[model samples]
Target: MSMVINKQLPLPVLLKEEYPLPPWAAQAKVRRDEEIRKIFTGESDKFIVLIGPCSADNEDAVCDYVSRLAKLGEQLSQRLMLIPRIYTNKPRTTGEGYKGMLHQPEPDKAPDLLAGITAIRKMHIRAIVETGLTAADEMLYPENRSYLDDLLSYEAVGARSVEDQQHRLTASSLDIPVGMKNPTSGDFSVMLNSVTAAQHPHNFIYRGNDVTTSGNPLAHVILRGGVDKYGACMPNYHYEDLVRLLEMYEKRPLENPAAIIDVNHSNSNKQHKEQIRIVSEVLHSRNYNPKLKKLIKGVMVESYLEEGCQTIGGEHIYGKSITDPCLGWEDTQRLLYKIAENC
Candidate 1:
């Protein structure tokens, strides 16, 4: 083997026992999960917003940002459903760069997988106990899902991992909603196939056990735009794009048959400020077409305590992102209120 054997780490059950959730937090998670489920099942008319930093690099800053969002959720209770994004693991295109909190809890520190696991679990627990919000996370490593499975109410199968067999199978076994994004090459068929695979029964080898999953009905699509053959960003958040997705959904046996528009990524061309404008355009499209309003459940926004991104390995800004550029809290709050009024 090319890799060195490391010490065995604590399993998910042991870790949960070590840092168990409080009674209030456990009850809150149940309520949040049910509300989110209603949104996917077409029983709720309120819009959903998955908003937070691109990478949760700091414990204090992430909790602070989500605490503010939890308050906003209270203010916009009737119009929208807010699920903070506490992404602990990040996907690197070349297997380099800071791999988020799961690889390095501290941006300037060296990689420590053991400490990273504890830090991520503690972060999620704090977000729920203090703020009463059950956040979302990306399934970067399928086997690592169990670590935060109880703390998270939403999950995302990133564009790069949505087509992977393990990701699809793992998502099938998950009880939470999993948003499968279109591939980097902009292939809708690949995204659709992933959703189908996730929504059907599967028998696979997982954690050295032969497991059978009853399938996840909440498996759905997320339109985060895509990259073209020329390496340019191509957007699919327009009215025509959504209309095409509805057509595709009609042809499939998917359960929920809904999608979420990721306002960042290639859709905004990494232009963080463009997120607000893109959201406005999409909302306008939804209003113009009644069909679109039913099909698009919500949007995903990348925002933080500060605006833009900074390079790692220095005394960087406290709340700015170490990965991708994100909107500041002021802009995020403004956009949320605007969305609430419109919704």
Candidate 2:
């Protein structure tokens, strides 16, 4: 057998019991959820800024960043809705390297899933309780969602996972807003098909039981551009790309038609610093065609306390990213203020 059995980790339910969110924090999560869901429904005009480190590798750094966001949020409360991108489980194409906080809570330590579950749950609770700001996390592992479900306000399906059947089905069940990204292949129809599937009810086997989802009307599209067969990046965040996506929505009966542009990834060709210019261009596009604003809801940015990335090992910088490179804290702040101004 290729696989070896490690000790079984406790179920999500038991973990939740062990690290329960405070009553006040739970209330805060509900309020945050309501505010974010309205953005998809077009009930609010506030722009969303899903900004944070590429992967949340350290707890202290994450909390420190969120605390600053909390203060900034108070300043831009009327114009912007900031959601910390506290992504814990990162998808690896080759299935090697540091997976994320879920695989190893400590960057230099061995994998301890039990500790990981506890660490993530506690960190989310602390973010909510301390800052009163619920977060957005990628649903890299559908089953693991139950572990943080109570605290998360938004969920995203990455470009790689957008085409998977389980991802679509699971999105249908989530009551919160779910952003389905265009697949790595850059197929528009594939992404729209996912949104359609997620917006409709479905019956599927999940977690050892038969379940039926009520359908998620808030399910929408995310344009992170794409990669081609030749291993080159292809962008889809241009003026034409937004227009085409809007046209696609016009042809479908999907509910609350909206799209969020991911400024990094294939769109920026993985150039981290380009996120600043990308955000400006997207805002300009939204402003140029007032109609496009209906479809272009916001942009996702990868940023951290430091400007670039460092490999995981001994003597790591306190707040720099360990995976993909990211914009430093100073740049992140200035860009956000500019976004608020533009919006």
Candidate 3:
């Protein structure tokens, strides 16, 4: 007798059931939703500062940073909104290095995804509930979004994933505001295209099922710089670039005309110190340009309790980043005050 195949069998499982969000997470969701509404309504002119470690590899370090950030946020609440970057998942360029807390919660032990996810969620909840502050994170894996979606007030689509159809659909369905970064290769067209795609209703398959999105009007652009023809990074937040981008948005209105300037990444060429100067320069340039000033909504920066970064597997160092170098606490304070003064 010939053997028969069973086509009805489910695909082999890659992961187990997800852990439910803790009580703190539920409280955080309510708080974040209010802040998101204020941001989109233009009632809050405060520039959102999404500052934290390049990757949240240490739970204690992240919490310490947030505790300090919470105080600064209180002082600057009148002029700026502080959204701590509790980024638990990081996208790799060459797909190497530790992915993030979700992959390597225990530094040495083998990957315990369940433990990692739970640890990250706990950290995020603590930052929001204990510190009483909203948080921001880049959405990398689409399926993992729901785990932290309810707790986030702001979401970002990294340059590498901006043009992906799945991400655009994801953004459209998000209740929080989403910032789309320029393409990794330094193209504004792709960013604008992402905005268009994210702002319009879309019908697509989601998790083995069909779904339709009502479109996300809060989706906007984030000028994080692009690469030059000679392979050098170019900052797109300059007055000329900002003007051109605003003009492009005006001509082809998608979700919103506003944009956020990322002071780190290619914009600062990964130089943590230059982030402050670059942001100040952008502010000065915008002050001189009437139209540009109105379109620029906020700024994004990477900061941590301490300056610079250390290797993940190297000697355990407190406060330093394990992925990208960041502005130290002192510089972060100065930047926050400067932005408030400028406003």
> In candidate 2, what are the lDDT values of residues 96-147, reduced to their tens digit?
8888888899878898888888888888888888899999999999989989
lDDT of every model, 2 decimals: 0.94, 0.92, 0.81
Instruction: Give the best candidate by lDDT.
Output: 1
Q: TM-score of each candidate?
A: 0.99, 0.98, 0.90
The RMSD of every model to the true structure, in order and in angstroms, is: 0.8, 1.0, 4.6
Per model, how many backbone clashes are there?
Answer: 0, 0, 1
lDDT of 3: 0.81
Prediction 2 global C-alpha lDDT: 0.92
> Order of all candidates by lDDT, from best down to worst?
1, 2, 3
User: How would you encode candidate 1's per-residue C-alpha lDDT over 172-224 as one tens digit per residue?
Assistant: 99888999999998889999999999999899999889999999999999999
Distance from true location, Cα of 185 in model 3, Å: 1.6
Model 2 ranges with Cα > 4 A deviation: none
Best by TM-score: 1
